[model samples]
Structures are given as structure tokens and as C-alpha cells.
Target: MGISPLNCGWGICVFLSLCLISFTPPCDGGNILVYPVDGSHWINMKVLIEELHARGHNITVIRASTSLYIKEKSPLYKSITIELDKKVEPFFIQYLQKHIKAQVEGASAFTFFKITLGFVSAFSQLHLLMCDYLAQTLDDPTMVKSLRDSQFDLVLTDPAIAPGVILAKYLELPLVFNVRWITGGEGHFAIAPSPLSYIPVPRSGLTDKMNFIERVRNVFFYSIALLQQRLIGPHYDAICEKYIEGGCDIISLLQEADIWLFRSDFVFDFPRPTMPNIVYIGGFQCKPAQPLPVELEDFVQGAGEHGVIIMTLGTLVYDLPKEVSDAIASVFAKMPQKVIWRYKGKRPSTLGNNTLLVDWMPQKDLLGHPLTKVFVAHGGTNGVQEAIYYGVPVLGIPLFFDQYDNLLRLQQRGAGKILHLSEISQCFEQSLMEVLHQDSYRQNMQRLSDLHRDQPVAPMDQAVFWVEYVMRHKGAAHLRTEAYKMPWYSYYCLDVVLLLLAAVTLLLLSTVTMFRFLCYRCLRKPKAKQH
Candidate 1:
């Protein structure tokens, strides 16, 4: 039964067509997975998710809370817990492990630390998960496996969660890390000051002895860390080898990424590394105005020419001490212009006629209004970006975390002033007066604001363009750096052992030459005596 040549060729073509159909990803509904660090919906994830959904992508949101859903109801919200175990689907584990192995060897030391810290910060994440009221909706292993098997097109993630990132890698999905603040750049600490110029020298400059003590303290602490790493390093090494080949190569992930969207203005000193993948998409989410709420509009209009000042301490740090509140109230009472505060807790008893305290306010909308003069803030990145967007100068009362760093940049840029927690009374009042009365701060802020707004494309659009570029290019390996593959010593060019050997050889030769010259001179003296 000999098959005819023409019939065989046609059969092969039909077989290949079916194979292509089976392998191709479904275009009818592309999944866009959102992986927020627990309860981090407020950290620009909400807006991004909404935007992605609006663009007609089928979204499967893997978040850590119901608090996010409480304010905004959407069909896309998938209440899945992020905890991964053997109970998870076998296929997902296989995909994730395989995917991570390919990328792990090229990760940077910094990336390694960030991914490890994600594991260490589990307590913090759990706390947020509990606080945000999302403990019950965790995704079971099977569901996660099923989703991975389905093969999503893109993963929008926060790098603080290594597991989510690893999952993205396993699924071969295009990923984007949402860096909420300007924490990666030098001097721009997430929760503290950088160890660069600002060595923990006290502000008074009277503690020379303390600096020595601090140095010794740091050495001892680092020694302890080394000792611990030595003890557990082998175990971790073994585990990583067993699971993710080459373990945690975070640097490779950073370099291989399509683009890094920094939500920071140029005023933020983003330690400019020579990398093309980094993009300053500083105020992507900040949109220009819609008219203010009717009551708020009338209130601003009624203020006549004195205008308005807005005071807010963002979401997490809203719990200001009563004394601090009293001090702020006292200062605001003295100002001629009207003040509107988004004080979340109890309203103060001593409210003046010109002041209004509300549980919440449309912060960006208020800042965008023409009558708003100054901002008193906790110096959160979003607030800082908004203030910069609106060209309104700030009086930063930085309490804790990266607030201090953000405040410092604003002060250095001449766009704002910083008032420490202890010196808030004198500093805050004085700074507020200067910002309002003097025109330089406002003018400088406006100049910077204009530069930020004048960019070629809006930040969010640029972000979307890059995301699509990654998918189109099938991971964009052209953007990845070769530097990531080099060993630490090779990268630093430390051939010190070879240099030491060369120095020893030269010293020995020089000594032998000197000895020979002296002997010859002595022998010549003897010959002269004999003559």
C-alpha cells in the first residue's frame, strides 16, 4: 500500500497546521496578572490594574487583601492567597522552577538581597495581609498551577515578593516591577538614609567619639552576619542548587528586564547607572484636573484671595501624636489663609474658623486646583510627585522611613523645606510662612514641574509601550547586560595576586643586581692595590 507523493505532502502539511494551532497561545483572551506586595493596592497598583482592564486585557488579580476591593468593585479581582506549597498544582511548580533556573544565574547581588529580603519580610507582609483584611482568599496550589498552565501573557509585580516574580519567570510571562518609590537610587533610602555621604554623624557635629563607636558597632554587626552566613550559607547553597539552578541571581533579572519605570521626578537623585533599560516615568498615574467636589469648590471660592493650604500625612502614617496635632493646629491657626487637612483620626476640639478637617480628601485634585498655595505632607512618594506635578511647594514633616530622604531631595532641589518631628513647631511654622510669603520656592517648583510635564509622552503610556515591546520581542534579550554574567572579581578587575608576585620578583632582581655591583667594585679595588 504505497502512498502517492502528492497525497503524503498534503498529509504532512495538515499535520503541521494542527501542531501550530495547538502550540499557539490563545489570542481571544490574554491574561494580565497583577501581583501586589501584600495589601499594597494603594501603592499605585489600583490605578494600574484599572488602566490594564480598561485596555481590554482579561485580568487575574492575585492580591493580599479585600480592603482593595472594598473601595473599588471590579469583575477582574481574583481573591487568591499567594502562599505556595506542594498543595499547589504540580504543573505550576514545574513551570516556575524551570523558568527561574534559566534566569537565576545572572541575578545581581542587590537583586539577590531584595529577593531574600522578600522572604525575610514575610512577617511584615502577614501583618499587612491581616490589617488589610485578606487572610482567607489565598490561592490553592492547584488553582495557581492551572493558571500557570493556562500561560498568561504578562505579569505586573512588585519586586518585594520573590515568589510572585519567580512564578512569572516559570510561566515565561513578560514582567514589570512596580517600584513605588525612589528607593533604589543612592541617598534615596526606602526607610532610612543611604550609607554614602551621610554617615550616622549626629546633626550637631559635636560627636566625633560617637562616629568611632558607630564604626566599631557596624564592624561587629557585619562580623556577626558573616558568621551566620558561614553557618547557613552551605545549606542555602545546596537548597538553591536543588531547586533553582544558580539560585537567586537578581541582577540578571534587573538587567534582562524590558524597562524599569521609575516613579520619581528628575529632582530625585536617581543614582544614574549606564543602563538603557531604566526609564523615568515619574508621574504616570498623575492626571490633570476635573473640577473639585462642589462643596470643596465653593469653600475655595469663598476664601477670597488668601487661598488654601492642604495638610496630609498619607495613609499608613496618619496616626500622628496628639501633641504633634496640637502643634500643627496651633501653627495653622496663626496663618491668614484657610487650611484643609485630611486628618484620618478624631477631629481636634480646638478647630478654628478658617480650618476644615475631613477623614479623606481628593489629594491630587486639590493640589491641581489654581487656588491651592502650599502642601504640608509626610513626604510619601505619591504625595511628593503630586506636589511636584502641581508646582506647589511642600513643608515636609517627615516622621519615619523614606520620608526623610524624599524631604531632603525636595529641600536640596529648593522646591520644599524639611521640619523634623521634634522641631516641627518652630521649623514647620517658619517654613510654611517662607513658602507662602517668598516667591522663590513656588517659582523653582514651577520650573521643575514644567520640565516633568514637557516630556514627549505621558509616563503610563510609555510604561505600556515598553510592556508591549517585551511581549513583541519575546523577552527582549537585546536589552540585557553582559556585565551580569561576569564573576565579581572579573567585574571589579582585581588581579591583585598577580601584581603581588610581579612586585616580589622585581624586588629580588633589584637586590641581586646591587650585590653584584658592590662585589665587582671591591674586586676592582683589590686589583688596583696589586698594581
Candidate 2:
């Protein structure tokens, strides 16, 4: 059945025409641009992008750093990495401006030195780096103009990175934010627990009073949050030489967003508020199981005899203390179950043969294994999600920040046990035994896993829908609200009521003091006259 040259040419033309018809333009793919907070943050996002691509959608990624995408080994290597002048450079210029302004004859060296040096020390802190970088990025004119020219219909960002919110507004686009961590406010999502529950809210079931030390630490944390909003944000604007842009305010942006997809589960027990836009797609980032590596196959296969416990503290918090590692080793020494700890950093000498210590392991794959019974991990959102997806019980040893929150949520759900950092030294063996032996934890995990698996639509499908929906609706502006634009005083009711109460209380105190003073004077005069 040899075809003529003319027939072959016609067949080629037909194939080309079909592909063109099926291919959607980049702009028509609902032109969704996703700007994750960091490269690592994109792991969950990749699952959603794959789903969207399957649906014949086009996506563009704008990354904060190249390192994030490089590590993922994604096929989509054609990504745009955003570069900015060093974050510290702006602070340097601002300090110079202040130093120059204060260089007058009246300006004392003490004042100048104190002001300049104080900021220098503060700037040295590593926590300020991301915020500073975001502030500077917003200040660039060409970058801002480029975003405007792109005309992306929807902007997906993590709230941790403020620039995404600002850029969304600059382009007059609707936003969909992945609330990766908890912050205060309605419809806020956290892979971790909310600090608000620690406050005395009735029925919250948290009754323990904070110690002086705990209170001080909390105060410091809150102060940093305030400083970011008040100082760093405006400082960013000053450096950018532009007023803040985006959907007007945080509330407005949130309201205007087509969807607010949280990477949380119903079992995690996040504070649920009644909002149309808010959707619980927590385990959406997790997809169906993939196969494990060939080298690890034997260990996983041998798991059913005594069962298996997978221990991993997640990638972000590696290099645990020597004491903690020793405690873990002690537990592994006793356990009959084949323990596979994803031990990062140099392996300590105390490790046992029953344990498999590897630099990294396919976490989701391990959880999915039928022989796997429990997960021993540092409570992270990613870890929690994986555990839920596979119905694996957990022993969560939270180190700091949202790890505490994430661990607490698992505890409340009865899906896991919360091991204090201190317990890692003394009670490590006992805690591991309890976690492994407990039937309730395992059952709870299975229950949650079922709920997560039974969602009406997969997280990827939901994310893809909202993304394209924004483009279809030309930026879901109808969903936006006026609450974000209200003045702070109005929002908190601090302006009028608090001021009136203060004024009235001071006036009454003054009157009482004056009356007492007059009475005392009269009594003294009478006593003196009699004498």
C-alpha cells in the first residue's frame, strides 16, 4: 500500500491542521501566571499545573529564584526567573539618604551613629531578607510595567510573598492565593495551627495560661508581623518610588479573588468561616501514588513481617541536634518494625542496623506502601498531607514556628501524637512505642484519608477551574469586598470607642483627685487656726 508523494503531502497537512485547531494560544489558556513564594513552594503547585495542562490550558511561571525550579526536575524548564538588585542594596541606599539628611551642623554624632547602627544590626537578621526582596521588587518601574503589559487574567501567589499581591493589582487581575501558612483573619488557611486559638477564646478548648516567657515570645512574634506591615511595606514603596498597588488592600484582594484554595484538610481542623470563595483543597497537592526506587524496593517489600515506620523531618528543617538524633537512634534500637529514617546531615554513629538512614526518600511513595504503618516526622503541611493521603499514623516532633501548629492540628484530629522537643531526649523510646502501638491513631488516620480521597473533584481540577474561570470572567471583581479598604480605626472600632473611654476615665480620675485635695486643705487650715 505505497502512497504517492502528493497523497503523503495531503496526509501531513491534515495532521498539522488538527494540531493547530487543538492548540490553545498562551493568552487564551486563560493566561494564568503563577508566582509562588519560592521554588520549593512550587512542589504542590506542579500537580495542579499538570492537571491544567491536560485540560488544554496554557500556564506561565514567574519564579522568584531559579534554584526552586531547578531542583524539581520538572519537564517545563522554559520558566522565567525574576532577578532583582540585591535586597540589601535598597536598605543601603535608604541608610545613606538618612545619613546625608542628618549630616547638618545641628545633627549630633551620637544621634547619627545610633540611628544608622541600629538599622544595620536589624538588617543583618536573615528573617528580613524575603520581605526586603519583595519590597524592592515592587519598587522597580520596568518590572511593574512588564507585569501590566503581560495582562494575565489571574495571579496565583502565596501571601507570604507580598509582591504577588501588589503585582496582581498593578495588572488589574484577579488573584488566587495559596495560604501556605496561618495568619490572622477570616478565610485564612494554615498548614499549621492558628496562634489565635492560644488566646482566650471560649470553646476553643485551650485553657492553659501562657507563662511569662511564652507571652514575651508571642509579643515579639506579633511585633515583627506589625513591623512588616507598617514599616517594611512603606519602606518597599519608598524604594520603589510608587504607592502600593494591587486589588486596593489585602481584604479587597482576597474578596476580588475568584478562589481561595487552602492546602488543608477537614481533619486538620482549621477554623472554618462561611465564605463563598473559600474552598478546602488541602490534600489537593497530593496525587495518586508513584512507584518507589528499585534500591528501596526490598526494604518496602520486607515491611509486612513486623510492619514499617517511616521517619522523616521534611526537607526544610534538616540537621537536627545531636541529642535529638541520639534519642531517635535509641527508639530505633528497640523497635521491631523496620525503621527508615530520612536522616539528613552526617549520620551519627549511634544508628542501628534495623534502621535505614538515607539522605532523602520518596516520602509520598513510602506512605502509600501497604506495609507502612506510621510516619515519624517534623509536623509540616506537606508531611501531614502525605500522611492523610496514605492513612498513615504519625508521631510529630515539631521544632518551631508552624510545626507546632501543624502538630497540634494532627493531635486534635487524633490522627497523630505530639512529641515535645524535650521528650526527644528522655521519652523518645516510650513515645515511639506508644505511637506505634496505638490503634486509635491508626484508625483516625485511615478515616481522614478516606475523607480526603472522597472529595467531589480533585484539588487540581478545582484549581484549574478557578484559574481558567478568572480568565473567562475577566477577573472575578464581583467577589471583591470593601472591608480591606476600611481604615484601621474603623475596622477595629478603636478610633471612637477606645478614645472616648480613655477620655472619660481620665476626667473622672482628675475630678476625684481635685476633690480630695480641696478637702485636705480645708481640714489643715481649720486645724492650724485652732492651734
Candidate 3:
């Protein structure tokens, strides 16, 4: 009589339930599809992908054959490479090379537009080629069937490229954007509120706090960007229609994105309005510096108390003009500090005894080294972020794109100085001396570094958490604002303005008619009496 059959059955049921709960694995992270704009973007996103993989998410990367530099051989992730038209790759490279040369030579204002239009034309050609290839792939019954079978959870892509949005629409998956630059263009503003009065346009070379003239200039730049977007946007829409069942606009798709992971932090960027869906995960790709190669380590150590200076112009800028190279070498020759320059071009005839020129260098590692004194760079966003991360002062020689704006921000922070290529021959030594001899530059950079590092969770961890959050919640719809769904006129309240103006006009017209009738009545009585 110790236990009845019913009691035993109840106990057995409870035991089995507890066992089931205990053995059940944590929610498996969802399948993620990553489509980066280029090799550089892939490099920036590599850390985030690896973190997601570690968390048990299935990751698939779709890259163009021309951009397969980061070969993912990991068992955790898979990669699919698509080939572009034969002519596209070579033509793109040639166009970029020509533009870089013109930029370095300080192309005239008229030539600048000519160069810009040429680049845009080349980009459009390549874009059309990619679109055609994608259309062909998606049109194939087998390929479409295979993709539908995969049942992807979400698409993480660079929205800077229009094709990414098209791919997302074709797959019928939630989209999450990964923007490598701080200033996302007009499409970003449409999704999030960025007041033009305060927030400077990207590449405008203006700061957050602006004068009247600066504000006007910002608006002008924004208007130009809008015009350009309008002109080129229709082509993208047409291309997207060919692949996806229901044609979608790139901007509309972007507005519906689950979240935006921006490669920027407030510590380095000016404070601006942001929507709930925008997440700043800057410096997630950065890691503690690895040990340098023995030869490089020896050279760095050999400088002794004099220290070393690191110089690089980023991956795209392979070389400098001979005269520019000569001028830079001449300045380095007089310095006591050792210089390690990354140069892929011809050896400078005036190469200094204290300078060691190499075709490639581990830039982040060099910046993190204790012996490194200052960074002389092209002011690319990645390089500037690395410099700030390591608390190294910069002497930036920005050429084009957002480089000028990046340097401008750095200079504003008192952590760096801008050295324009046009004035480099004359100001190279002076700017170099200022960054090296001035204590303020180093001190300011160190403070920013501290702020950047003093977070509850690491940037990489934060990024991984948010990415998984969106997946678990299925697009994070709660984070999206109603602004995305609103039309331009409605958001700006143009209709309200029109209503108020109409009311005022009607009132004024009625009062004027009444005044005229009173005047005629009074004057007509006097005229009748005289007659």
C-alpha cells in the first residue's frame, strides 16, 4: 500500500517531462545568407560571420567570382561564387585605375565631373551585367527550386549595392543591411530621420555643428544626391523586376529591412538622429594585434627610443606619382624615427636610410605596436578606425569618396591633421612634425580609445546579440518606426501646410471684398445727394 499504480504513472510522466526539458538543445540559430558588395566589405564582415557560425547558425556567402579573395573553407559556413561577364571585371579595374590616377593628379573641376560620370557609367555597366547574370540564374527552374528549398531565415547584405535587395526579394526572406560606411546615403535617410540642418551629408566635409553657409551647402549636396538617385534608381527597379516575382523598389525594400548594422560608433562620429532599427557595431572586425613577423619585429625594435612611423594608402591606392613619392621620401630622410611604408609602385630614388618600403604590411598590427609613433594614411574609414582604436595620431592624405570627410572628423577631434595631396609637397614636413611633436594629438586619441573600449559588452558581442535577436524575433518588427511606411509628403506634413495657406487666403479675400462694398455704399450716397 506504499504506492498505487496511478501514483507511479504520475511520477513516471513527471520524470520523462523533466528529462525532455533538460536534453533539449538551445534554439538552433537560423540560417543566414550574406551577400557583401565587394571583397573589402567581406573582410569587414568576417568576424560577425564567424561569431554567428560559432553560435550554431548556418552561414552561406554568395560572392561574385571577381571577389572570392576570402575563400571560406570552414565546415561551419558555405560559399557560392557567381561569375560575371568576361568583360566586366577588366573594365571595372581599368576604370578605377584611371580615376585614381586622375584624382592624384588633381583633376580640374570640369574634369572631375567628367571622371565622376565616367566612373558612374562604368559602374552602371557592371551593375547591368550582374543583374543579367542574376536574372538568368533565378530564371532557371532548377536554380529557383533549389533556392526555395533552402528555406533561408534571413538575408544579410550590403544595401549599398542594389542587387542585394533584388536577391532578398527573390528569396522572400527578411533583409538585414550591413553598411560599411558611417554615412549611409539618401536611402538611409528615407528609412531613418536625419535632419539636414544639423547632420552633415556624407562626403560634404562638414561637421555636425554647422554655420548658415555650411547648412546651405549641405542641402545643396543632398539635393544633388537626390537627383542622382532619381536618375539611376529606375534602372535598378527594372533589373529587380526581371528576377523577383513582384518587382520591388530598392528604397522600399531598404525601409522594410529588419535592422541596419552600421560600421560606426558615436565616439568617432558626430551625434545624429537614429531610428530604433539602426545598430552601431563599429570596430567589430578589429582584434588585438597579433605578433609581427620576425623581420618586421626586428625592424620595429631596431628603431629603439626613436620609434617607428607607419604609412599606407589603403588597398585601392597601389601607388603614388613619382614626384609625390620623392617628396615624401625626402621628408622621411630627415627624421630620426624609422619609417615603414607600404608601396606597390616603383622604388623611390630618394629612399631614406631610415625608411623600409614593402609591398604589403599588416596595418592594424603595426598600429598596435608600442614602437609605432604615428600613422600616415589615405584617410579611408577602415584605416582611420584602426588608428583611433590603437590611439595613434594620423597625418591623413585623403583623395576621394568619404576619405576627405573621415579626415575632417579626425582633424576636428584634434587627433589628426589633413594633408592634401595638392599641398603635400609643401606641407608634408610641417604636418608630419605637428602630429609627431604635438602631445595634444596623442592625448586626444588615447581618450577616444578609452571611450571606445569602455563598453559593457564588446562591439563584436553586441553585434552578434542583435543579429541573433532579429532572427529569434523574426525581423524585429517592433523596432521599426512608422516613418518607413509614410510617403515623403506625409512625413514632411506638406498637406498640412497647404491647408493652412488655403484658409488664410480665403479669409483675406473675404475681408477685402467687404471693405470694398462699404467704401462704395458710403461714396454713392454722397454722389446721389449732389445730383
lDDT on C-alpha atoms for all candidate structures? 0.61, 0.64, 0.79
lDDT of 1 at 498: 67
Q: Per-residue lDDT for 339 in model 3? A: 98
- CA deviation > 4 Å runs, candidate 3: 1-27, 72-76, 87-96, 180-187, 507-531
**Cα lDDT tens digits for candidate 1, 29-66:** 34677666533224576676666666666767664323
In angstroms, give how far residue 484 of model 1 lies from its true place: 3.0
Question: Considering every candidate listed, which one attains the maximal lDDT?
Answer: 3
Q: How do the predictions measure up, each by TM-score?
A: 0.71, 0.71, 0.88
Clashes of each: 12, 7, 0
lDDT of 1 at 241: 41
By summed lDDT, which 10 consecutive residues of candidate 3 come out lowest?
A: 180-189
Ranking by TM-score: 3, 1, 2
- Measured with C-alpha atoms, the lDDT of residue 446 in candidate 1 is 94
- lDDT tens string, model 3, 1-531? 499999999999999999997652445768888877664666677767888888889988877666645574657578776765454446645766666677668778788778767766665666666666667667678866866788888888876666667777777788887774311253446676788898888768899999999999999888866755665566677866766567777677777778888888898888877888888877777778999999999999999998999999877667788988999999999999999999988888888989999988999899999999999998887888888889999999887677888888889999999988878788899999999999999999998888888887777877777777777777787888877567778889998899989999999999999999999988885434553
Which candidate's TM-score is highest? Answer: 3
* Error in Å for residue 468 of model 3: 0.5
